[model samples]
Target: MSLVKRIRDISVATLNDKIENAEDPVRFIDKYLQTQKRKLTELEKLYQQTLTHAHSVKQQFMEAESNRIKRENQAEVAVKAGEEQLAKLILLEKMQSEEKSEQYRLLYEDGKQTILELEEQIQNLKDEVQELVDKRAFYEAKIESIRLQKQLNQVNRFIEKQNYYDQSRSIDQKFSELEMQTNALREVRSNDTKTGSSFGGKLQSEVDAQFQQLKKKLEKER
Candidate 1:
């Protein structure tokens, strides 16, 4: 397998970029969404590549380990058969394979870590995009509510002005009833003024008021 260049720092912090040409909240959200999508797509592709590279490294490590073990077994058989020269050559090959395995193992581990970080970055981007979508929804609702409330206020003002005569007529009728009650009370107080603040006289005057009302009713009938 061809050697791959190491992927350095892959942080979501690096994903942040200024959104341009946005006029309003919604537009800002739109532009931000576009940028995030593009970043997510690229990150995902990178993740796949990283995954494939890690697998390649793992395969190489396994192959090198297998070769080392095979050579070690072959060397042991050669030594048992009294072929010391052959055993030395096999042992040397085994050492080379062992070293290669160690190197590949380290690379595979590094690749795995890179893949994890890439996955984390992708998820973070997705979460941020979702958060922005929620904010856009909230902003849209608030903007629409403001527009509706303005229209409602205007309509209510016009309708309230239209109802002025009706409300005033009702108020005037109540005022006239209050005025009548006030005049009756004034008449009572004036009539009681000559009674010299006598409680019994005031009580008797109130009692006589009912009879006066009955007499007025009888007069009306006649």
Candidate 2:
């Protein structure tokens, strides 16, 4: 399937190939894991079938060899019993059993080789699938980080493109103007505080002089 091809192309050996703009790397990896897992199951079933075949071949080879030995014994007994015709028949049967055993032996050996190859394939495929399963979280998290970094880069570009620095300057200018106004207000309050104290002293001195003049007039009348 295309998923197999896609996943296979992401080489861990070569650093050149990158995980591209896959919308979801997890889904991509999962598709591959699922497909390979199916293949692994099929391989195991075939492995079992080959094992059964190999067992059958071995059994056939053993049976033929056993028959050959039995015929040889019978042929010796026949020859000792002075039965030449039966001995000849038994010898012929032994020869045929010997040939059959040889053929079965070859078949059994070939079956075992086939089983070995299939076992290797199954194990290799199983290991590859498991590696993907184990590394799934790591790759997914890395891809997510890449996606966020890309967005952050885009945001920084937009800020530069839209002249956000000028906006920042305008905000700074407003704060500066606000600070100046505050300073002006503080100076005006300070001046008013000093002027109010002087005016209070002058008014109090005038009231005291008027009170002294009224008391002198009352003393002159007495």
Candidate 3:
């Protein structure tokens, strides 16, 4: 193979290896399909070349066979005319043509078999590549689904925590308000009792003073 052809083969093989071992199923599958396409393209080129070679070989064999037949006919004619030397030359040429034809035929047969093997290899490679692509898609979808589920779970947990914190803060505020109200009420009651006791003591003192004045006035009039 030429350098360019060799490089192409190596590229395809490397891509195939990467596709086979990729962790991301989606990427692996896509790349695998791409590699298979490339491989098929290369195989197609090889098939065309094989076909051309086979055709050329067949053509050569056909020409050689025709020449051989003509020489044999010429040799028969020469023998009837009693020209032994010419007939001998013709027979020798016929044998050589037959040998060349046989050689071309064998080469053609070999080329044909090689072409068949290459085609079969192409088919098998396509089937295996397709199978791997499908598996990659399936695994990728499964991983995506699991990833989404995990994200949703985290969001739900965060929301629950937020609600819990809000409720806790609300309860604390309400309890603080109730405590203030209770303290206010108690203070009002204490102030009221103190005011009432002071008024009662002042009223009793005024009544006693008035009674003493009346006793002193009565003694003066006597």
> Which rank order by TM-score, best down to worst?
3, 1, 2
lDDT of each: 0.83, 0.85, 0.85
The digit string of per-residue lDDT tens for model 1 on 87-146 reads: 999999999999999999999999988997888778767877887788778878877998
The digit string of per-residue lDDT tens for model 2 on 10-68 reads 54433123223456667777886888899999999999999999999999999999999
Give every collision pair in model 1.
none
lDDT of 2: 0.85
Candidate 3 per-residue lDDT over residues 22-110, each given as its tens digit? 77757767766787789888988898999899899999989998999999999999999999999999999999999998998898899
State every prediction's TM-score relative to the real structure.
0.63, 0.61, 0.68
- Of candidate 1, the 10-residue stretch with the lowest lDDT total is 1-10
Error of 2 at 48 (Å): 0.7
Return model 3's CA RMSD, one decimal: 6.0
Looking at candidate 2, what is the lDDT of residue 182? 100
TM-score: model 1 vs. ground truth: 0.63
